[model samples]
Target: MTQCHEDRVTGALSVTGNAGGLFHLRDGAVIAVESAGSPGVETLLLSSGGISAEDWDAALVESVGTGSLQAALVARGSIGLAEVEAVAVAALQDGAFAVAAGDVQECVVVSDSADVPLLPVTGGVAPALLLAETAGRLDAIASLPVPLSPYRDRVVPGRATKSMSGERREIVAHATGRRSARDIAFATGRSLHSVTVEISRMLGEELLEIAPPATAFSFSHWGLPSLRPRAPGQSSGKEMDWTTTPWPPNCGRSERTSPE
Candidate 1:
């Protein structure tokens, strides 16, 4: 990114790794970015009711030839210029966060503008400013007691506590040991960064815990056996019956706990 800014280039930075994304730049300034691991502009717009599905589809059809959905939406009055810009900017920043949080192996500059698909959202943001903000977020996550990967690390509700409310409460409600932070973000229509950071705090608070992956169990010749691990500090020489890990005390409260 520094090299692109230095050269004052125009095009997209194609990145490939654990989670791939595209950074669309114009004159070395980032105009837009799209991360596959996070929700994009369309999802944000439609999910947040910024634009109706019918209207969005209409604008998409109208923009088929021009490849400019922004222009099409503005012309059709489906969305105002200010609103589109705001949503686009939010999506761009969230996309940048998603890419940074993942494992990126390589990034190459694609000099051809035709190869870039994302449209310009804001006037443009300097690569340095964007990188600085992204780094700050990553650093904050790293400083947490339990750093998390938005795309991995399924979480389950831990000890019951009345302290959680609002968005944090909603996050706990969705943390059913099935969805990762990314999946929770998509399910809740929130940013992946927000969900990840909240989960990290909850983990630190002992309100959430990393869930073990669910796998099939094989029955021994005698009968089905427990799948729980031996108690900590127990010597390997000791022979005992392993019991099932108990659920959190509040897991069965009178609430709809089915995961989405």
Candidate 2:
């Protein structure tokens, strides 16, 4: 990444390993990043109610294969460019954290012809700034009494409790011995970094525990309900009912340490 920044390259860096990511750089500055271990910008926007399902579908249609869904959304006034940019930034930071938290075996540079990000940070962000923040998040997680990998360890509810509320409560509600922190993030429409860190702290509180190897889980999306996030330009053919999203009523567009 440092080398790419120095060279002022505008292209995509495809990283492959335990967890992988695609970093989009424009003029040497990172505009966006995508990682399977973390929710994408599309998920963030839809899950946060920053845009509606119909709005996303319309944008996808308008952009077609142009890879300019961001422009389409803005053109229609369905959402502001700044709002989408905020979500893109959140996705970028969390994507970086997800890739770093795992093992990275290789990163190959692809030409600028690679499809543009559905949404990108306007003016972009310095790679150094992103790396610094990701490092800080990792350091905070390392400081936990029991640092846990969001993707590797399946967790189950611990010490029965009824008082948990907000995100933590939702997390516990989904810790059914069949899911990892990553799964919970997908189910809750939250950033993987936040979910992983919260789960690590909860382990210390005895509110969660590692699932035994012998634990039998259905594995069908773990038989747990999902937030059913729809990727941009990819539709389910059926409109999603998103009125019951689990986001806290107070959740807003502010940039969180690990925005979801």
Candidate 3:
């Protein structure tokens, strides 16, 4: 979240890393965040069985039909309002985490006269809150033994558990000595913090063993969805598909009292 001085970015802040991303902040609050590594809200919902793929597609259609995805899903009884909020929050945190790991480049700003791209917005998350949650995740993972950072560390099945089932068992089973903690989180549709905390404990109990780290989620390997540019005649307020948009779309703009 470092910027020139304590100033918020005027446009898109491009970050380069294993998962390069664009962070858009307005009035110091993030509106839309796209990350090359983080899973989309749709992926989380479908993965967690919050909604089936078919239901997700139906929701999309419903969104276009109703002009609001949030309303369509809830109105159709596809998911509760709270679940939608949870998905947005998780996507925001994961996206922020990826951006934080990267070296932020100079941000690109749009001219006042130019039309800003109307990209889909997940939710507005305060940058400070995102950073705080990320720091908490780091500290939780830091409590573990050597070479575990949750994002990169891979774990393998060590000793069998006492037939326990929960986050701990889920993590140990997937620890395949290959998948990173992020991977486990996606597979289980749980938050990274919850997964990593269990991982630390499992490691302590010898239920999981650290594997020689493999190339975790890297920028090159991270799959970003394809974004179709809006037609030239498209209105800026028209809805855009949130999933297909790449990271670094128009994030947010601040109402600066004074120009930088």
Best by the lDDT measure? 2
TM-score of each: 0.74, 0.78, 0.64
TM-score (C-alpha) between model 3 and the true structure:
0.64
Taking the tens digit of each residue's C-alpha lDDT, what string does model 2 give over 1-260? Answer: 98889999899888998679988999889998889889998888888987888988988998986668889988878688788888889999999998998889998988664567777888888999999999999898888789787788989888856567688989988988778888899889899988998998889888889998756254322232234544443433232244344343322222334323
Clashing pairs in 1: none
- Among all candidates shown, the one with the greatest TM-score: 2
Say which prediction, candidate 2 or candidate 3, comes out ahead on lDDT: 2
TM-score-better candidate, 1 vs 2: 2
Q: Give lDDT: candidate 1, residue 234.
A: 44
Worst 10 residues of 3 by lDDT: 111-120
The segments of candidate 1 whose C-alpha lies over 4 angstroms from its true place after superposition are: 161-166, 215-260
For model 3 the local lDDT of residue 235 reads 23
Model 2 clashing residue pairs (backbone): none
